[model samples]
Target: MDVFIFQLSEFAQLVFETTWLPLVIWTVISFGVWFFLQMFENVHPIYQYHTRLALIFSLPAGLLSLASIHYISDWITASAGDGLTMITVISPIDISFTQVEESSGIPFMVIVQSLAVAIFFSGMIFFLIRFCMHAINLKKLRKSLNYRPISEMTSLSPENRGLALATGKNVQVAFLNSEIIPVTFGFRKPVILLPDTLKSQPEKLNLALRHELTHITQHDFFSHLMVILTEAVFWFHPLVHRLKRELVEYREMRCDNIVLSEASVSRKEYASLLLELIPMPNLNKELSVNMAQESSNLKKRITMITQQSKTKPIPKQTSLILLGVIFISTALAMACTDMQTQNVFDEEELDLMTNIDKTGEQGFHEIIIYMSEEEQAERHESKLEQLRMLEPEHIESVHVWKGD
Candidate 1:
């Protein structure tokens, strides 16, 4: 048991140290790949498809990296040990698979099954919490927005003029009691709405309408719903938050481009109009409509538009080279599992009974005691109880070893 505990602890330490570099490399690669894919195009069909693929591949890549670490550790230990009997001790339990027929105590199948069950329960708890939060948010959004019916017609108010043109329908616009939110709700027959004050200014109303209509044309509400779900599912990853922010910005940029292209408005003119209608007093109320927030990025948006040119085409060879590099990196990471050795010990020849007092004196006193399994178990239990009684601040760690 003592030998097993020592070996298992060493194995865990080895795995952690060996895998740290590879894990860091993979994390950076994954983030960079995803970021570049996002920046290559605004929220278009191709960009969305690539983003989904990146997300799907990243999960398995992360899991595989972790598994490779464990596999490497186990392989090294097994190789080094050769044919000697080995056991692994995890707290009170000791697992030995070296001589399965003779020992008949703890089977390898039992350990694997137990681990699977624990993982299953942990995953269930995580998903349950995520689903509940999403359901609550959906209910709140439905209750907060009042839906008004609409049919075919021409522009009604200045606020919904852009929406009418974009949807190709004279949609009815509602004045929600809630401030500057212009949301489209309901299925089959959708309704668009704006704040009552927005109807006064023609310029402000036009800009607001363009923003909202962008939402309708792009089905941005549905995109937002998908983002929210992804965030809930991956609440633990900081990258998930980063991805959401990037997607929101891209969505807005795509819509802005569409609106500007159709209106044939130069960057300066559109930017001037955007600044004038900047929702100063009602900025807080406009949070729902302006997903990116009214910040300095407004200037960046104008710069992007002013500098926009035809996207440079990538050569097929360059694309192939990039893909090849990614594949090679992944292969190298996976290959690390194949080059490990195992651990070994000779129990009979070592004469554990005689070597009981052979502890080398260093900084601390070392003691070795020889005892039967029953006696050793009792001693271990006693020591554990004593350690528990000690104040956590005063106690460090206790190490135990066995004599043959």
Candidate 2:
């Protein structure tokens, strides 16, 4: 159990170290862009939405790149004769658990590190379980509601039917007898769940359909799923939650913008529709995009609908260039940070020792030593003698294990 916990701690430390720089870069880039957007006006909501989405997935990509670079650089250093070893040198010696404990019970840092990792994994599991529960609720909600295909609804006029078809062939729409607000969800088979009350009022129902269909057209459901997954993994980060909220706001605003651009309904009437739905209860919102989910964003959505400017849309090239700059800057920052951490190699050496320990047979005392492959090939015996001599005074017996 101790070994197991220690292994978990080591794994956690490695992951945290590998990801810390990228995570920091992500937060800085996300919040900096979000704050800038807050200060400005009329920066096309779709542009804002895409920007946040890119940042959402960038952190993981950056971490993978960083790991690849780190290992590749190490290999290049070894091949170029930069004094780094290519293979781990392992020489085992008899070192009893008693002697090891008496000399140093356990490093204080190791226990503390293990505790921290335990807490992190616990929180992650808790959030993951919550996400699963929400999914189950969504399943139940789908089954319990009395629903029928929107196509079968007699009240859908020709225009509304055309809009529904244009949304997508895979998109599913249903009018269900429920008190909850209209919501959009699903990935392969996207769904729009509308309240049955809208059946008697064709105009309001059409407006609701437009809003939910706009969500499907923009692929907000997939975005919502990705963001929720991110939130579950990074449940501890405040910036992650903030990112989620920002995406929600921007996507909804963008959806509203698209609906308004069609000019099928006046802004005043649309805003009034939003007002009527503002207080409706939301169900499984994290898994779905609930129209008018909260009061604060509801206020912003209404404000944008009523007061938006006819600003020229940002060119795609410009947006890509800006995103490229942010990504490049983040990479550079990570490189600089890595250069400053000289002890990272030592930590990796310790990891190799831990791995060697894992292979110890029961009832056998073992001491694992790490050396460069080059050193072992050249001055194997002399280096081995020197390392053995350098072994701690407390070690009474010595047995070395060498690999060919």
Top candidate when judged by TM-score against the true structure: 2
lDDT of each residue in 70-144, candidate 1, tens digit only: 677679766765343343222221222244556655555545545444454566567667656655653475566
Models 1 onward score TM values of 0.45, 0.73
lDDT against the true structure, each candidate: 0.49, 0.70
Of candidate 2, the 10-residue stretch with the lowest lDDT total is 355-364
Query: Candidate 2's residue-wise lDDT over 1-404, tens digit each?
Result: 77877887798788777677667767777788778877874687767776777676666556666777788888787677636654443444445455453545556777888888888889889988987888888777667655556677677767667777776656667766667788977766667788878878788888888888777766777768778887777788897787788888877887787777764567877888887777788877777788877878888888777776542443557766766666566555555556445345544544444443443442344445555454643534543444345435434456555553
lDDT score for candidate 2 against the true structure: 0.70
Output the TM-score of candidate 1: 0.45
Q: Which 10 successive residues of model 1 have the least lDDT summed?
A: 341-350
CA-only RMSD, every prediction: 14.8, 7.4
